[model samples]
Target: AQSVAQPEDQVNVAEGNPLTVKCTYSVSGNPYLFWYVQYPNRGLQFLLKYITGDNLIKGSYGFEAEFNKSQTSFHLKKPSALVSDSALYFCAVRDLTDKLIFGTGTRLQVFP
Candidate 1:
């Protein structure tokens, strides 16, 4: 079965600094990876995705990810961090069944 792993349970960053949430995936074939962010009381919001395109893909709210097939990794990144960006970030991959297999979410705490 395909799976994703978010090694860090929590990530702390000061406001105005850059941030990154690590993600690694395992699948049988070409992987379709995605990044989502969840706010305090809101549903998961789409951030970005990597699906047979340029290695670097950008998405909503000043976010982006790099598709590194050789490393089997797709780490989320932002040029600068904001306190409002604090939320639970998830890394997922499309499985053979077309279902999203999500990793243990990483909580991003952006401090002021």
Candidate 2:
């Protein structure tokens, strides 16, 4: 069994500031992690994935996440935040059954 946790319910940041949404997972074997963003009442959009290779993985919309195996964490990051970046972010990990188990979601709000 695998599960993801997003401790923050909401993250508020000013424009131009770096932002991060935390995620942690627990799984039996190799873990396949993914990040997705969703606008109001919309479907989740694929951001990035960490299946193998470099620990740091980049994705759409100038987003990146670091895969920390020892910590069992994959925290999403952005160099400089934008007001348009505000959205609901989700983290998911593939379970043994090959199903995506998603987090409760963390709402991000970027203000000018």
Candidate 3:
């Protein structure tokens, strides 16, 4: 069984400051992890993905994620955040059946 858990419901950060959104997951076999963002009522947009290699993977909008196999965790990060970066984030894991299991979701609020 594959599942994702985003402990935090929301995260607050200041513009131009670094920000991080934590995520953890459990999956069977090879874990295909992905990060997506939702702006307001819009649908989710792809950010980045981790298929293999390089624990650190870069994504859109100056974002990145670190994949820790031992800990079974993938945490999203950004060196500097912008007001526009405020949105809903979701961490997903693709199961063997090719079904995407999403996390509870994390809402990011970036204050300028």
Query: Highest lDDT among the candidates is held by which one?
Result: 2
Supply the global lDDT for candidate 2. 0.96
How high a TM-score does candidate 2 get? 0.98
Clashes of each: 0, 0, 0
Tens digits of lDDT, candidate 2, 1-112: 6999999999999999999999999989899999999999889999999998899999999999999999999999999999999999999999988899999999999999
In order, candidate lDDTs are 0.95, 0.96, 0.95
Supply candidate 2's per-residue lDDT for 3. Answer: 96
Q: After superposition on all CA atoms, what RMSD does each candidate show versus the true structure? A: 0.7, 0.6, 0.7
Model 2 residue 39 distance off true place after TM-score fit, in angstroms: 0.5
Residue-level lDDT of model 3, residues 1-112, one tens digit each, is 8998999999999998999999999987888999999999899999999999899999998999999989999999999999999999999999888889999899999998
lDDT score, candidate 2, position 97: 86
Candidate 3 stretches greater than 4 Å from native: none
Kindly list the per-residue Cα lDDT of model 1 for residues 1-112, writing each as its tens digit: 8999999999999999999999999999899999999999899999999989799999999999988889989999999999999999999999999999999999999999
* Span of ten consecutive residues with least summed lDDT in model 1: 64-73
Once model 2 is optimally superposed onto the true structure by TM-score, how far is the C-alpha of residue 30 displaced, in angstroms?
0.6
